[model samples]
Target: MTLFRGPVQAAPAEPCNTFAVPTVIAPIEGPERVVWEPDGPLVPWQVAGADDLWVEIDHTRDLLRRFEAEGPQPDRIIDRIENAGHLVVVSGPRQSGKTTLLHKAVHSLALRLDDRMRTWSNVEQLVPAQERWTARSPQELSHVRVVALAGPRNAPAHVAWAAGRPLDVDQVHDRILRKVRETLGKPEVEDGHPPGSEDLYVAYERLSRQLIEDRTVLLILLPDFGWGGEGLTGRFYRSCRDNARCGIVFFVESRNDTGCADDLRTAFGDELGTENVTHLALGPMAEGDWRDFIDARHRAAIPGAAIRVAAEVTDGAPALLTGASVGKLRKVLYAATQHAHENRRDEVDAATLRAVGRAFEVPGPDQFRRDGASRQQTEEPRP
Candidate 1:
C-alpha cells in the first residue's frame, strides 16, 4: 500500500461548467452608484459601478480559490513579469481556464507586493506580507504596482486602505481607482464614476505616466475585459498601446477570437511593438503542459510516461482536463495509476493508458487537436 504526500489534493467533484463571460450587459443608463449589502437577490450581471465592481472582483477571487486545481506550473507570462519589459495578452477559447490563469498570475504578483506592515488575505487565511513579498529595495517596492480589473461586465471594485499605502488588495485596488479619478479630475473619494466614464484604460494610462515619472513598475491584470466597441475605455487603451513609453505591464484575457472592432490585435500589433505588449494565444494544453499540469499536484504520483499518454488523448484541451463531465480525465488517470500499482509497476504503462481511455470513454491520441491559434486573425465577427 502507498500513502499520499502533503500536497496531493483530490480532484474536484464538480465540473468547470460555469461561464465567466458576462453577456452583452448594456452599460447602465444613469450615474452608477456603489451599494454595499444590497437588498434582495441580485444577479451579478445586472449590477454595475465601483462597489459592485469591487464585489465582482471579490467574488471572482473567491470563486477561483474554491476549486481544487492541480497546481499550475510557471509559464512564459510569469517569467516575463519577473524580468520586466512585457505586457501580456492572454487569449483563449470559452471555458479554457483563461480566468484561472489570470488568477494565478495575480497571486504571483501579490507575492511580489513587498510590504512587511501588511497582511495578505487568501480565501481561508491571513498571510504575512513579508512572506509573500519580494522586493530588495524600498524604491523597487514603490515603483512596482499590481492591479486586477474585473471589467465592465462585472461591478467596479472600491477596496479602501489607509493613505499612501498599498500592502493589501483593498489598498492596491483603491489606489488604482483613486489615481485614475484624480488624473481625470474627478472626485477621488467617489467609489465609482458615471457610467461609461469608468474608462479603465484612461486610468491605466494615468497610472502608467506617474510610474514612468518615478521610474516605478506597474502590472495591471484585466480578466474578462468584455468591453470593446468604440467606447471611451476602448480608445483610451488603443492610444496607449500605440505609445512605446507606456511603462506598464498588462496581463489581459479576452475571447480567443474577439471582434476586430475590439482592436486587441491593433493594440498589440506585430510582436507587441517593442515586445512591450506580448500577445500569447492560449489554446489546448500541449502534451507536455498536460504532463506538467498533472505532475505539479500529488495526484497519486502517476508515472510521467502514463500521464503523457493521458494528456495526448485529451489533445491538451483545458475544458476536457478540468471539466468533471467532459472526458473524466482526472478520474481515469487515478484509476489507471492504481491499476499499474496493483500490477507491481513503478509507472503507468501503455496498456494501462489504453485500458483506462477505453473504459472511461475518453478519446485516443488520434482525435483532432484544436490549437487556439488556428482561429487567430481569421474568426469572423458574429452578426
Candidate 2:
C-alpha cells in the first residue's frame, strides 16, 4: 500500500479579467461627454443585467448589502482599489455616479476586511490554489468604517472652508477610538496618551499610529469630504499619510476644486507624493456597451432597435440611466417591445426610443442647455 497526496485539480481559470482594465475615453462633441471604448471581452451578463442598467444596479446593491442605489460600478471601483493600494482619491464630474462607485467598493472591502473568507466554499476554492492550508487559524478582523456620505444637496457649503478654526481632532480621535473599541470588543491596551496631556490631536495621532503599526484596517469613505478646514479633521487625513496606516477614499466632483486638492497636498505631503495617490477618472459608457446592455435586458435582439436614442438622451451616464423609477423604465421597455412586436418590425426605431425618453422627461440638448444657462444666470452674483 502507498500513500500519495496528488495535486487536486486547479480551479477553473477565473474568466480573464478584461473588464478591470482601462480603455480609451474619447471626448464627445458636447455635453461634457466621454465615451468608454468597449474593447474588453467582458459582457453585460458577466457583470450584471445584460442591457438593463436598472437591473445591473439592483444586482450590485444586493451583493454589496446596500439598499439605496441607482446602479453599480463595482467593476470599475474594485479595480481602482486593487491598483491603488490602501489610499485612494477618486474624482469625476457631478452626476457621474461617484457615490455609487464608492459605496460598492466599500461594501466589497468590508466583506474581505471583516473576514478573510465569507464561506467555507470560498476558502476551499482558494486554498488549494495558494497551497497554504492551515489548521486552527486565528481569523483577524479589520475595523472598516464608512465615515461620511456628504453630497451636493445635503452638504454645508463651508464644511471644508473653516477659516483658521481648530481642527476637530477630538472628534476624529473619538470616532477612531470608538471603532477601535468595537474592533477589540473592549480596550485591549493602554499607555498611549501622556498624563494630563491636553493635546487631544497628539493623543489621537499616537493612538492611531500604534494601531497602524500593529496592522489594523485601512478604509474610510467620505463623499464630498470637507476635511480641508484648518483643524484636527484635516490632520487626521495627514496622519494617515505620515503613518501609511490606512486607506482614505475621497469621492469628489473633480480635482479642479481647491478645498479637497489643498487638503490632499497638505496632509499627504510632497513626500508621500503621487506614488500613494490614485486618481480614478469615471465617465460614460460606450454605445456598444449600451447595445449589449439592451440586448441583455430584453434577452432578444431586435434587428433595427438599438440604444442610440437612450445614449444620446442620457449620454450613457449611469447616474442619468439609473436612479430613476424602475416602473418608469419598465413601462418604456414594455412599450418599445410591444410596439416592435405589434408592427412585426425587427428592431426598435428612434421614434419608439424618443417616446421612452419623453416618458422619462429626459431633456434634449437644446432644452438641457437652456435650463443650464437659466440656472447659471440665476446663480450669478449681484453687484
Candidate 3:
C-alpha cells in the first residue's frame, strides 16, 4: 500500500528582519569580536544560539545524567516502576518531554534486554494494512514485546475515523488481540478466546510465553493513547492491569488538562490505579543546560565564529528549540550582539531578549494571550 508523505518546503532563505531584535552587550566580560558569519547558501540566521537565551533544547542524555546524579524525586517514575507495578502513564503539557522520557525509558530497558526486546512508536510508521490479515505461518510472529500507541492531540480525523468504525467494544477488543497474536506468531485460535475472556490480557500472556521460550524480551511503545474515547481508554488500561506477564504499557500524553489523567484513574479504578502507573513530566530546560549546549556548539565552531545566540522560540518548546539550525540561531545571536555593541551596554538584558524574540516572530505575550483565548473557545462545549 502506498503511504502519504507530507510535502517538504525549503527553509526560508531571507533572514527574518521583523523578528530580529536589537543586539545587547555581551552579558559576560569578553573581547569585542564578531561571533557569527553569513556565508552559507542556506538561510544564515534562522534559529537562536544557545548563549543568547534563558532556555535550551532538552537533551535526553543530560536529563538522564541529572536524574541519576541528583537522586530520584519523592514521586520518581523509575523508582515507582521498579518497586510497584507494570503499567505506567506519563502525561505532561504540550512540548513537555513526555515522549523524550518514554524514549529514555526504552533505552534503559534495551541495555538489560538487548535484542530480545523491541521498541515501537505509534507515530513512527503506519501499521501495514496486511497486519489485519491472520498470519498463516510461524515466521510471521514475534516474541515478548513492548508497544506504544501515540496520536496527536486534537486529531479530529483520527477521532472521526474511530467513531465511524462499526465494531462494538468486544469486537474491537478481539481484533486488537488477534493482531497481537499475529504479530507474535502464536497459534491462531481455532475457536477464538471467550467473547469476554480477557482476550487482551490473554494475548499479553501469550506474548510473555513466547518471550520466555525464545529467551528474548519485547518492549512496545504506545504514545498518543490520550486521543480516544473513555471506553477505549478504559479497555486499554484494563488490558494492562490484567495481563501479568506483559512487559509494560507506557502511555504517553501531553499534560494539557488534568482531565486526561483523572479519566484514566476513574476508568481503570482499582485495576489500573495511579500507584501502578509512572508519571513523567518534561518541562523547560534551565539556563545551565543551555550553557552546556552553548559550550558544545562553541567547540564545534570554526575558530572565531563562536557567538552566543539566545532567543525565545515557541515558549521554549523542545521540539521547536531543537528543530531550528545552528546557523539560524547564530544569526539571531550575532544580530543581538551587534546591536548591543552599538548600544554600548555592559550586558544583554530582557529588552534585548524580547527584541530578538519579536524579530524572529517567536510568539510573545500578545500572541500567547490570543492563542490562550482561542484554545478556551475551542474547548468550550456548545449549549
**Each candidate structure's count of clashing pairs:** 10, 9, 41
Off by over 4 Å in 1: 1-86, 103-142, 151-209, 212-215, 227-237, 243-246, 257-263, 266-273, 288-291, 299-383
Task: Give model 3's TM-score versus the native structure.
Answer: 0.47
Model 2 CA deviation exceeding 4 Å by range = 1-86, 103-173, 176-184, 187-216, 226-240, 243-263, 266-269, 284-289, 292-356, 359-383
Which has the higher lDDT value, candidate number 2 or candidate number 3? 3
lDDT of 3 at 336: 61
Per-residue CA lDDT of model 3 for 140-192, tens digit only, reads 12322443322211121222125545334455445545545565566652225
Per-residue lDDT of candidate 1, residues 299-349 (tens digit): 322113232334344444433333322114445555666666567555555
Provide the TM-score for each candidate, comma-separated: 0.39, 0.41, 0.47
Q: Tell me the lDDT of candidate 1.
A: 0.37
Q: Candidate 3: what lDDT?
A: 0.39
Report the Cα lDDT for residue 138, model 2.
Answer: 23
Write the candidate numbers in order of decreasing TM-score: 3, 2, 1
Q: Judge candidate 1 at residue 171 and give its lDDT.
A: 32
Candidate 2 global CA lDDT score: 0.36
